[model samples]
Target: MQTSLAKSVTFNGVGLHSGAPVRMRLHPADADHGIVFRRIDVIGMQNRVHATWDRVTPSKLCTLIENEDGVTVSTIEHITAALAGCGVHNALIEIDGPEVPIMDGSSAPFVAGIRRSGIRFLRAPLRAIRILKPVEFKDGVATARLEPADGFEIDFAIDFTDAAIGQQSKRLEMANGAFVRELMECRTFCRQADVDHMQAHGLALGGTYENAIVFDGDKVLSPGGLRRPDEAVRHKMLDALGDLSLAGAPILGRYVGNRAGHAMTNRLLRALFAQPDAFEYVTLDADQERLLPGAGVCRPVALAG
Candidate 1:
C-alpha cells in the first residue's frame, strides 16, 4: 500500500550554501500525487516542482530542481532521503525559500520529525521501478551503476586525499529501517581546504563547525569528530538513496557508486530509463510490498540511540 504523512510537519533553519533562513512544511497528499515541492515565496508563477529526475538541474554541490518558470529549490537531498527512508510516497513539500534546511547536515532530524508525526496508509496500490538489466555510467574515476535485485540495496565507495578520510566503503540492504538507523545521522563532510575555497567563493555561507564535519590534514576539526568510523561512505550512500528517489517511485535495485555524486547518479538514471528493456514498472504483491524500503521500517528503533 502507498503511504502519506499523518499530519503536516514544519522545520526551520538556514540553507548550507545560501545562508538564508527558511521554513518548510511537509503536508500529506492524496495517493499517486508523488512528491512535489511548492515555492510558497513565489507568487503568480508556477511554484510547484515535481521531485523527479527530469527536473534536476546541473549542480556540483547538491541536488537541485527547477521548474519551467525558473523557480528552484536547492540542496534537497537530505529531506528527500528522509521522505524516502520513512516510506512516504505522496507529499506536498512547501518551502518559503530556495532550499531545505540543512538540519545537522543529515537526514536524522527529518527522520525524527516524520516518526513523531507518524504515517498513514492510502488505498492505492504501490508501483515500483524494478531494474531488469544492468545500467552503468561513468566519468573518469567516478562511476554509478544499477542492476536487478530482489530489494533496494546500496553500496558506495569514497576516497579522499586527506589522511583523516582516506578510502571507505559500505554496502547495505535498505530494508528493516537500515537507512534511518545507520545512515541518517552521518553528517556531510569536507576537507578544510575545500571549506576555505567555498568560503572564498561566497558559498557554504551557513556552514560552521556544527553543521558539517571538517577535517584538516590529520586533525579532526568538527568538534566531536565522527559518529561512526566510516561516516563518509555512509553519508555517500545516504546521498545516493536521496538522488535515486527522484525516479518518482520506490526502486527495487542494487545501486553501486564509486566516487559518484549527484550529476553522475542522475546520468545513471537517464541511462536506465533510456534503455526501455532495462527496467519495468510493477505493482507490488503483499509479500513483496512488505519487503520494500518503506514498508518494514521500525520507527522507534530507527530513531533510537
Candidate 2:
C-alpha cells in the first residue's frame, strides 16, 4: 500500500548555503501525488515543483529542483531522504523559502517528525521502479550506478585526504528500518579547509560546528565527533537514497556510489530512464513491498547511528 503522513508536521531552521531562516510543512496528499514542493513565497506563476529527476537542475553541493516557471528549491536531499525512509509516497511540502531548512545537517529530525505525525497507508496499490539491467553514469572519478536487486540496497565509498574522514566504505540493506537506525543521524561532513573556502566565498553561511561534522586534518572539529566510525559513508548512502527518491517512485535496485554526489546520482537516474530497457515500473506484491526501505518502521525509541 502507498503511504502518506497521518497529520501535518512542521520544521523551522536556516538554509545551509543561503543562511536564510525558513519554515516548511509536510502535509498528507492523495495516493499518486508523489512528492511536490510549493513555494508559498512565490506570488504568481507555477509555484509547484514536482520532485522528479527531470526537474533536477545542477546546484552547488546540494540537490535542487526547479519548475518550468523558474521556481526552485535547493538543499532538499535531507527532507526527501526522510520521506523515502519513512515510506511516504504522497506528500505536499509547502515552504516559504527557496531552500529546505538544513536541520541538524541530517535526516534524523525529519524522520522523527514524520514518525510523530504517523504514516497513513493509502488504499491504492504501491509500485516501484525495478531495475532490469545495469545503468551507470560517471563523472571523472565519481560514479553512480543502479543494478538489479531483490530489494533496495546501497554500497558507497568515500576517500578524503582529511585523516578524520579518510577512506571509508559501507553497504547496507535499506529495509527493516535500517535507514532510521543506521543512517538518519549521520550528519553531513566536510573538511575544515573546504568549510573555510566556502564561507570565504559567502557559502554555507548557516553552517556551525553543531550541524555538520567538521574535520580538520587529523582531528574532528565537531564537538561530539562521529556518531559512528563509518558515518561519512553512511551519510553518503542517506543522500543517495534521497536522490534516488527523485525517480518519483520507490526503487528496487542496488545503488552503488563511488564518491558520487547529487549531480552524479541525478545523471544516473537520467541514464536509467533514457534506456527504457534498463528499468520498468511494476506494482509491488505484498512480499515485495515488505522489502522496501521503510517497511514496518515505527517511531524510534532512540536513534542509533
Candidate 3:
C-alpha cells in the first residue's frame, strides 16, 4: 500500500552552501501527491517545485529542483532519500528558504524525524517504474546505468587519487529496510583539498568537521572517525537512492554507478525517460512490493550498519 507521514515534522538548520539558517516541515499528503517542495518564503509566485526528473537543474554538488517560475530548493537529496528510506510516498515538504538544511550531511537526522512522526498507510495502490531494458549515461569517465531487475539494488564504485579515499565499491540489495540499516548513518565525505577549493569559491560555507568527513591523503581529518569501514561508498549509494527517488516513483532496477554524482544521476533519469521502451509503469505484485527499499521500515530503531 502507499503511505504518508502520520503527522508533520519540523527541522531547522543552516544550509551547507548558503550558510543561511532555514526551517522545513513535512506534511502528510494524499496518495498520489508524490513529493513536492513548497517555498513558503516566496511571497507571490508559484512556489511549488515538484520533485520530478524534468524539474531538476544541473548541479554537481547537490540535487536541485526548480519550478517553472524559477523558484527552487537546493540540497534536497538527503530529504528525498530519507523519504524513500521510510517508504513514505506522498508528502508535501514545506520549506522557508531556497535550500534544505544539511543536517549532519546525511539522511540520519531526517530518518529519525520521519520515524518519530510515524507513517500512515493510504488506501491507494502503489505504482513503480520497472526497467524493461538497460539505459546508460556517461560524462567523461563517470557513468550511471539502470537495468532490469526484480528488485531495487545499487552497485556503486568510486575512485579518488587521495590515499585516504581510494577505490571503493559496494553492491546493496535495498530490501527489508536495508537502506536504514546499512546506509542511513554514513555521512558525506570530501577531501581536504576539495574543501579548501570550495571555500575559496564561496561554497561549503556551513561545512564543518562536525558534519562531514574531511580527509587528507592517508588520513581521516574529521573529529571522530568513520561510522563504518566503507562509509564513503555507502553514502554515495544513499545519494543515488535519493536522486533516483526524484523519478516520482519507486524504481525496480539495478542501478550501477561508477564515480557518478548528482548531475550524472539526473542525466541518467533524463535518458530513461527519453527512451520509451526502456522502462514501464506498473502496479507491483505482492512479492515485488515487499522487495522494495523500505520494506518493513515501520520503526526507525538504532539499526546496525
Candidate 4:
C-alpha cells in the first residue's frame, strides 16, 4: 500500500548552506501526488517544485530543486532520504524560505518528526523503477552506477586525504528497517581544511561542530568524537539513499558509488533515463514491496547513544 504522513509535522532550523533561519512543514498528500516542495515565501507567482531529478538544479554541495518560475529549495537530501526510508509515497513539503532546514546535518530529526506524525496508508498501490540494464556515470575519479537487483541495495566507498577518514567502504540491503536503524543518524562530515576553505569563501556560516563532524588530520574536532568508527561511509550511504529518492519512487536495483557526491548521483539519474531501455516502471508485488527500504518500518529509535 502507498503511504504518507498521518498529519503535518513542522521543523525549524537554519539552512546548512544559506545559514538563514527557516520554517518547513511536511504535510500528507494524496496518492500519486508524489513529493512536491512549495516555496510559501514566493509572492504572486507559482511556487511548487517537484522533488524529482528533472526538477533538480546544479549545486555544488547539496541537492536542489526548482520550479519553472525559478522557485527553488536547497539541501533537501536528508529529509528526502528520510521520506524514502520511511516508505512515504507522497508529501507536500511547505517551506517559507529558499532552503530546507539543516537540522542536525542528518536525517534523524526528520525521521523522528515523521514517526511522531505517524503513517497513513493510501488506497492506491505503490510503484517502483526497475533497472533493466546497467547505467554508470563518471566524473574524473568519482563514479556512480545502477544495476539490476532483486531489491534495493547500496555499495559505497570513500577515500579522503585526512588520516581520520582515510578509506571507508560499506554495503547494505536497504530493507527491513536497516536504513532507520543503521544509516539514519550518521551526520554529514568534512575535513577541517575544507571547512576553512568554505568559510574563507563566505560559505558554511551556520556550520558548527554540533551539526557536522569535523576532522583535522588525525583528530576529530567535534566535541562528541565519533558516533561510529565508520560513520563517514555510513553517512555517504545515507546520502546515496537520499539522492536516489529523487528518482520519484523506490528503485529495485543496486546502487554503487565510489567517492561520489550529490552532483554525480544526479548525473547518474540523467543517464538512467536517457537510455530508455535501461529502466521501466512497474507496480511492485507484495513480496517485492517487502524488500524495499522501510517496507515494515514504523517509528525511529533514539539518536543519542
Instruction: List the global CA lDDT of all models.
Output: 0.90, 0.91, 0.91, 0.90
Query: Any runs in candidate 4 off by more than 4 Å, and if so which?
Result: 299-305
lDDT of 1: 0.90
Instruction: Tell me the spans in candidate 1 whose CA falls farther than 4 Å from its real position.
Output: 298-305
Global lDDT of model 3: 0.91
| lDDT, candidate 3, 1-305, per-residue tens | 78888889999998999889999999988888899999999988899999988999988789999998999999999999999988989899999999899889999999999999888877788999999999999989999999999999999999988787899999999999999999999998899999999999999998999889999999999887888979999999999999999998999999999999999999999999999999999997678878988777865222111
Candidate 3, residue 46: lDDT: 98
Worst 10 residues of 4 by lDDT: 296-305
How many residue pairs clash in each candidate at the backbone level? Answer: 0, 0, 0, 0
Q: Tell how far residue 39 is off in model 4, in angstroms.
A: 1.0
Clashes of 2: 0
Residue pairs in steric clash, candidate 4?
Answer: none
Reference-based TM-score of each model? 0.96, 0.97, 0.96, 0.96
**lDDT value for candidate 4?**
0.90
RMSD of 2: 3.8
Q: After superposition, how far is residue 31 of candidate 2 from its true place, in Å?
A: 0.8
For candidate 2, lDDT tens digit of each residue in 1-305? Answer: 88888889999999999899999999989888899999999996999999999999998699999999999999999999999998889999999999999989999999999999888878889989999999999889988899999999999999898888889999999989899999999999898889999999999999998989999999999998889998889999999999999999999999999989999999999999899989999999889988988888844232111
Q: Poorest 10 consecutive residues of model 1 by lDDT? A: 296-305
Error of 3 at 139 (Å): 1.6
Q: After superposition, how far is residue 137 of candidate 2 from its true place, in Å?
A: 0.8
